[model samples]
Target: MIYVNEAADPRLDDFRDLTTADRRPDRPGGRGLVIAEGTVVVRRLLASPYRPLAVLGVRRRVEELADDLAELTVPAYVTSSEVMAAVVGFHLNRGVLAVADRVPPPTVESVVADARVLAVLEGVGDHENLGSLFRNAAAFGVDGVLLGPGCADPLYRRSVRVSMGNVLRVPFTALPDWPRALLGLRRRGFTVAALTPRPDAVDLRRLPDGATGRVAVLLGSEGHGLSEQAIAAAELAVRIPMAPGVDSLNVATAAAVAFYELTALAHPGHPAIATPRPRQRTDGGTVGQ
Candidate 1:
């Protein structure tokens, strides 16, 4: 609960300018600290395993976190928003920031060890999309995320903000060996479904029963869709039905829909996504596998 009034205070260095925030990546340490902006995200950072080094904010913003900060071991640097912006090199409308070292990402095997429904992503380099995907996954009760390739760092400041800090709670991992890693998932009883817009793909509602054990939805970036190697590695190419000529949904939105369908089956009692209500397919038959 220490109130810091000076920007020159040595205790505030960890919360310094964003211009060089990423610069530390080239330093001997070779990595930048995790930064959480806004009160919501900052509160999440404080709760995460990553040890909070310091908190910087205007008085009011820091006060919002007083409940969490009561027994916090870190210092809270309070300042005017103008002074805060001058030190941080931009006018951060969030009015607060917290810095913490990153925790290690989980191993792919561990992330999927007990996963009933997981989301594996490829070429998802946009931070906001990545964050939104995590939030959607959490809302739909997805178990985890496995990064296939070209995925952005989920702990990046913008990702943390956009996720509303859900990134701090959802566990994720980097799956090595590219598409080859998908084999390892299958070995553990996961039926990997690559979501794509290709018409020849099986309609989501008509997916096979093999998806029961441990299901994983393989996702791709919105721009180009899944890579050939990804599609080739999957057990099924699944497509969500949309009106003709409607193209597809946002990557995160698509994840939400697929997660809702898959996870509802995996965990029957989960309430947010109720049991699927039978609906007609475009061909005029009862839906759901």
Candidate 2:
């Protein structure tokens, strides 16, 4: 590991000016490089599929990640906090920073094959919401995430930090199949439940009755909720009962509540084994592109 005292070191370009460096390429003044701040996230990124370009930090922070950095063939630029802040444009309390190219996730079918409860997202462009969904999914025993249509990348720097690096731990796949692709899940005996606030829809608590096989929960963007196509494709639509009219919880918060209810419904021990849930049909074909 080669170390440098100057923040101007040419080898350290990847970790420079992180505050605005992570913006999308399409956005004005954006480089779109995948960035990871803090020791934990940087370490995960190094371990992830994305190849590490370089790392920059103060001496203490770099030393703290010595174990993680041991296998890397990249440069480790060590400098004073003053220099680091100046070069990065903003003071990063996390101390360490690593940058790498974005590595896309796998396709839909492989991600769903061995999963139980999967979270399918559509039009969830909010990074924080997406990250929180992955964190909640991991906490409640959900296996993987399927980016149905418009979900943002879970590997984005902010998402990684918000998820506390759980995004690296949980696998995610992008599904190009819109509503039509859900047919593949049906073939796998998955009862697709779209989480909505519709009154006529089945109650969220009423699920898991005979759900012995796989299941997928479809969620939509924060602004407009699920698309009509997504809702119509699912076997049933369910919603959480709130006090009178509490508008609705944030997408991630709503997901947490739904997860809690779903998990309880699935593992309700002795007294709840006999509850009757909507019948699950193993219908449809393999997911097509």
Candidate 3:
């Protein structure tokens, strides 16, 4: 650990002016780095496959990561909160931050191999939605995410923050050949189901029952939803039933519901699906026979 009194220390350059376009890895003139905010996300960054370059935080926040930093040889720069704010161009309420170099993403085939359930996305350019989808994917034991065209970079800072670091854990890769790649998934024995609000879509609850195969739930952007071509590529169209006058749910919110249903459909015995426990009465006996 090194204590730095000045915000201009060359060692802190990676985190400088984070809100600026030039500092955003997904934008022009930006360095391609995976940045993690807060101790929770920073801990996940350290645990991820990406290589940590350095860490910058206030004294307390830096020390809180002592165990995670123990085996690392990278510099952990400790400074006052004021210096941290000045260096980063804004006050980061999360206290600590870590920056890492992104490793190459896994291939689509590698991610798809041995997977029973996947989240396939198209035109999901919104980072938070993408992140939330990843979080839901992680929560339900999704094997991987297949990114179609118009998808945002999952490693972007905002997505990383919104996912609460789950983006680091979920494996994802770009899918080439546009909607045609989806056909490839089907050829690999996947039942590609496109999610849409179209009235003709099959109710999610009515999906054909069988836990004996792979399934990919394809989602689209929040605004336009799925394209006709993408929908055409899918083997089936599915929808979450809604009340009168309701057209659809938010992409990420819809993803959670779809992921839950699909995970149960594809992997009935997967550990994330917990067995229901008996409820007990206040008097200590079971509530029902």
Best-to-worst order by TM-score is 3, 1, 2
lDDT of each: 0.85, 0.78, 0.88
Instruction: Write one digit per residue (lDDT tens) for candidate 3, span 157-191.
Output: 88998998999999999999999999999999999
lDDT per residue, candidate 2, 58-135, as tens digits? 888889889888877877787888888878888889888887776656767678878777888999898899889888
What is candidate 1's CA lDDT for residue 281? 92
Model 1 Cα lDDT, one tens digit per residue, 1-289: 5666677777877767775675575544565688889998889889988889888899999999999988888888888998898788889899989998877777776788778899999999998999999999888888898887899888777777788888887889888899998877888889999999899999888778787567989999999899999999999999999989896799999999898788877776655675656777999889773
Model 2: pairs clashing at backbone N, Cα or C within 3 Å: none
Off by over 4 Å in 3: 21-31, 210-212, 274-289
lDDT measured at residue 162 in model 3 versus the true structure, 0 to 100: 93
Worst 10 residues of 2 by lDDT: 268-277
Model 2 Cα displacement at 172 (Å)?
A: 1.5
The lDDT ranking, best first, is 3, 1, 2
Ten residues in a row with the worst lDDT in model 1? 22-31
